[model samples]
Target: MMAYYARRKLPTSCLCRVSELRRQFTSASPLFFQGTSSVLSNRVPSSAPEGTRLTGCNVFKNKDEPLALADEEYPDWLWEILDPEAQQKKLDADPERKAKREWRARMRRKIKTDNFLKTMS
Candidate 1:
């Protein structure tokens, strides 16, 4: 491990010295303000206007409701994709899905029969 690190010419001792210097600088630095005399301490409370709703944090929007679009405007295929019943029908119509379902049912029945036979024996 030492030979591999030596071959790569990595300064392991310099890394420890750099970390110590960073720790000392961070501990001594007065960059962060802690007392109430700081500029951030003079923050004003947010208030929403009459009839408008506050949907999110610090967000205010008009009281106007969204207009509903006509269902006829959207494509038939889009509605078929969105509808749960239509999606189920589409999956049920697939030959590969039908085969897998039938195989699963047979395996479940076989498992139950084997368990019953083992219990009887």
Candidate 2:
């Protein structure tokens, strides 16, 4: 069965022809197979001058800098959304959420106890 499949000629498509042409062109070109010495030469200098840094984004603020805009410029809800402590405080203040949190904790403890008992048995 392996020999029968191996002897069979596979049908070639336009994609196969284009890929074969691309392979031939690339293999013949000296630029395509050039050494890493060219790449090393193209690299930026190790010691870049101070104050000019490459940032991934346009906002070039340091990591230590606060992300919040002025309170007047940003909406109150935006600040509330950004602050995890405020969100947690809000959740704690809500009676329904507090009950749900307690219920989840109880369920998790019950599940852990049940699994422990099963393993012991």
Candidate 3:
């Protein structure tokens, strides 16, 4: 006797559609509703607990003064890698910067970029 095979039908609804339906039905009541902030306040506590220090060193440790040479100092920072390229491209692409081409403007941009680069590391 020859064996016969049958293929199962694919689901009509996607995972997201099923999830949406489930969410709608489950949260139909006021207690479970997402928009009812007062009812849900007891279940969810906002903000970190007291005496919780933020991760990483504080940038304002040296008052409000910026670092003199951020690029030279912190070359490996994430902001340094991403920010400088974008800022350089913006400065290069701007028609006003090109037209002015003043040393002061270029210096200002460079300083700002370097200061940003130094801040994250």
What is the descending lDDT order? 1, 2, 3
Which stretches of model 2 miss by more than 4 angstroms? Answer: 1-84
Give the C-alpha lDDT of model 2.
0.46
TM-score of 3: 0.19
Quick one: best TM-score, which candidate? Answer: 2
> Can you rank all candidates by TM-score, best first?
2, 1, 3
Model 2, TM vs. native = 0.33
- The lDDT of model 3 is 0.41
Summed over model 1, clashes come to 0
Candidate 3 local lDDT, 1-121, one digit each (tens)? 0121113232332334345544544444444333324223322221223444423223455544332332223333222222333346666889688667677778999999999999989
Residues 70-107 of candidate 2: C-alpha lDDT, one tens digit per residue: 32444434323323444677787898998999899999
Task: Please identify which of the two predictions, 1 or 3, would achieve the higher lDDT against the true structure.
Answer: 1
103 in model 3: Cα distance from truth in Å? 3.4
Per-prediction TM-score to the true structure, in the order listed: 0.29, 0.33, 0.19
Model 2, residue 83: distance off in Å is 4.7
